[model samples]
Target: MYLSTRIDKALFPTAALFFVYFLVMVWVNNSYAYFLHEYMGAAQKNVDFEFVSYLAILAAYCSFLCSSKIRTPGDLVVVLLILVLVPHALVLNGANSFAPEASPFSGVPLAVLLGVSLVGLSNKIHFYERDSGEDGRRYIVLLASINIAVLIFIVLKSLGHFSLDFSGQYIRRALARDVFAAGSPSGYIASIGTQAFFPVLFAWGVYKKSSFYFFLGLLNVLVLWGAFGQKYPFFVLVLIYLLMMYFRRHGQIKTAWLLFFAIGFLLLGVVEHEITDYSYINDYFVRRAFVVPSSLLGVADLFASNNVNNGYSDTLIGVLLGSERSDPLSFQMGVSIFNNPDLNANVNFLAISYLQLKYLGVLFEASFVGGVVVLLNYLYACRGSFLAIPVALLFATKILEQSLPTVMLGSGVSFMLLFLVLIAAPPQRRATGSPQQ
Candidate 1:
């Protein structure tokens, strides 16, 4: 006798359905009026609604496959991007529109539809959940030691430059320099603290409902995001915990929901401190959030203006030192010429990859993204636990704005990530709200 898994049987039909949906969205799509609106007496659209709606449906489907658990900082990123961020971007992008009308065919609908299909390929997958135990003492020690040392350094640095001001001075000062060096305070936080420590600890705190880990996670946020004037570190973590308590209440105490309000109240304080001017929302949501979509302009411009540089030299720099890490003369010239700073914000992974390797770069970038979905799905297939979802989200987060090369090569990211993922507790027998012992 032969047996087949649910995924095996459903794969073809799902793929066919995805293809048909793509066609329908593309064929029956809206005209210029659909994606854009009149603003300031001009027709301008920032986001494509058809795209956002399509992605939401797909994300909902993907969430259903993952058992609909949203319990990690990483999960928040994916969910918020699909639910809150993208939609917000769509609405706000139109706020500044000066165009007369929308385009005949919008890539927003097609791109998101395609993205949904690609994301769905990871459905029905699973991973092994390695349990936390006494055997991991050395690993705990390793993390603790690093955390302590960095904490001390960050404190000293803060004291050396302490002030009661929140006039964007601190943030402006900090962001002015390269913060990715091992010796620099931010390099440790952004690269290591944010990547390795915060996610792992925050996940543990929410999973176990332990104050020790919870506060510890906040400390990580303090040095990396909070002190730097970035609120996302704190925001993403608290959001994940609240969401978990609401969605999966097994280990959670009845009073845990209080933490949600507490975090929110505190977050509002931080937001007030960070706002510099009247354009805060425009700066944060319109300019910052929509970078990924607006980034398509950079890619298009690069391809339109320049002959392919063949990318041989830049690719080497990208892999070894991350993007423009060494900043060789040739690399500097190339960035200025091809990946022009003319764009208001950071470019997306697609633009970075194309700048480095042209069409071949896009292929590599797609494959890596696809691989992430596959690996995460495979883990889910094996374990079917909550842990699998966040870990996958964490890995995917690295690719959202940065190129794969930057993510892979920067900091001690690869080694530290291995430690974080390997040390996670194994999945419980069933995927449910009950706390893990």
Candidate 2:
């Protein structure tokens, strides 16, 4: 019976879903590679076909592991599989031009292995579950109000510099940097508001079927985009809404649909690029989102080999350890690799960990991240809260460009975890609402 159950779980809908997802990902990967080589003249070298086949086999096995473990749309393993591991797999598939000198064999497989291990190990180690029984709605509303107030103050403070013109986004982004410099109160507030408070409020609104809170959350997203000139909030808000609606209707998260949407959007961008001779979507969404983060694994690995490891000096733990400081890691990477001092070549956490302590750092970071995933999954399982989806999604995206410590603390995920804990309702509430209602 145990063996039968394992086979059933591994081969049925879950495995089939990921199989389709993987196929779409491969198409997306090949399409992007062709775009880079043909249109951009990047002269990207394709890895051995045998090597690509090997990576595909590995990815298939990892997908099986992930399929067996995924319990919800909000699962950390889901994000790791889709956002982290898929990109790395694609990188090995003739997409390594971002670091020509760096070995494609190194850094990426380690990251993939760690990701698969996390998927396998998740829910294996159990944690104590507790519910506060507090009024989740009340606390969520209070938090939203406070974040809204803070956002208003930020906008008022920068009223003179504010410009909503999309074309002037770069200038406004620079202004935002000056206004909300790192470690400043405004910076922290913006992170918390955007990453935690607003997302939760928006999700809660969806749950309660409250149009007021729903549109209010969207209005805040616009305010944030106008004030900070950051475009992620708009995209993330839309994604959260869609995921929430899907979950509500299906009563389960379907990984295949997510992949279908991703592939659809990607192909749309590619078609637009082909027709108009424009590459903004290709550059920003395709290259920046997937290719760069994956290629940075090799770049970070190569950089770490020749230089002194950061010894956690780039994080809060480094400050506590009194480690000596230099230019930020992203800036250093930007200057060294891209020859651009102004660029911030931020990368995924695995690469950042490798930069800090090489292979051992990767292991430690993976373990830490896996533990956090388990904790978040525990909370979600106990409460079955839709709000966890957005928070987890935010953390997943942040990790694509930030270090683990920065994603957890600076990006306000730790605070969001606390918020999840505070707002966790009884398991009984999970079945209270129908999707149609």
Candidate 3:
């Protein structure tokens, strides 16, 4: 019975639905002007009408076989109604709303409903582990080999012929720009800070243990604050916490002296003068002190525009795609999703999340087709790091961006494709290497 049960695919229908949604989304994108002006825009009469239609359609077509059974049919109906209605209300009324043009609650509400329904279905469809055999070992070896090759290339580049300017002048200019308000100080700091972030992330991946992830996460936050000295650190801190929790679940790490360091660093920033720049260290902090306020202000300005612009536009996405760039916060967010070879910029996970919402309209994308794409991305990519990528994406989306199919496909498609191989590969049984936990 167990074997027979396991033989049935858990998410075949969900997978199919997601592919169809993806195709539809692509079609919609190509013909966006029509749908946006005709159906969605025109449906704005009586604000609640759009939501009502969505609920009615979901009820009419979707089967509730995946949802939980309640004590009575009436209770079941009530649960279903709440699952559908509550998210809609929250989205329309809650902080999630961005543009006045689109119903304020629309995106969030749909996100909640879709999330609930999918979760219910996932619960019904238990994801069991299969014996991957020698193929699994081979996959891990292949992954590790690829990582090693990349690392070797970096090492060779750094040690063999690399002659980077390694200039602190950029930092000085950034500070002057802030002091004079000539350009965005936050942008400079964020740009430099983002340059620093990859090392920290790579450290976490190599460490591959929970404690290392925690330590690296805290380290990244501290460095971000020390270097940038603004609200931008908050995103990195949040991401670190998420990574910490994720690793902790795997028993990869424990809260230890690392957490202590983070707390101490944060405190130092609040009280100690010029702590963020650490100019005292070698004039770096002193220089950053001049730039910190401007950089911080720029980050604040971007958020303030949420009220002014009504919705995020191409500006933010362009930043990610390296077509246009902004101050540090925007640069970091943009760099995270799309790797800019021209700038020698790598992807930053935290930045990717923020841009998703900033450019894509978060709740709307997540609750519907976008959510499934993320799920499939998980199934296909980041095999060894399954929950991490999507969780990071969702986290980024929640605070900074929204999920858009085209955005995901256009910029991140290749990386996502590579990640799928990782997920399909099996875990190592011998567990050859361990971090310094």
The number of the candidate with the highest TM-score is 2
How high a TM-score does candidate 3 get? 0.34
Off by over 4 Å in 2: 1-5, 8-48, 68-70, 73-77, 101-105, 123-135, 270-284, 383-386, 425-437
lDDT of 2 at 162: 80
- lDDT string, candidate 3, 1-437, tens digits: 01112222323443333223322322222222112322211111222555445534443223232222221111122233332223222222221112223332233333334444443333232222322333233343343344344333333322322222234435533443343231344333333223233333433443345354345445444433333233344544554455445544553322222233333433343344344533131223311221221122223223434423223344455546555443333444234322332222111222222334532433343344334434443342223443333333333332222223323432233343344445465543433343111
RMSD of each: 9.1, 4.7, 16.6
Model 1, span 33-93: residue lDDT tens: 2222121121234335775564455534533332223333333334333332222222222
lDDT per residue as tens, model 2, 280-349: 6667776655555555654565566667888888777887889866677888877877677987867677
lDDT of each: 0.43, 0.63, 0.33
Could you arrange the candidates by lDDT from highest to lowest? 2, 1, 3
| TM-score on alpha carbons, each prediction | 0.59, 0.83, 0.34
Q: Which ten residues in a row have the lowest lDDT in candidate 1?
A: 31-40
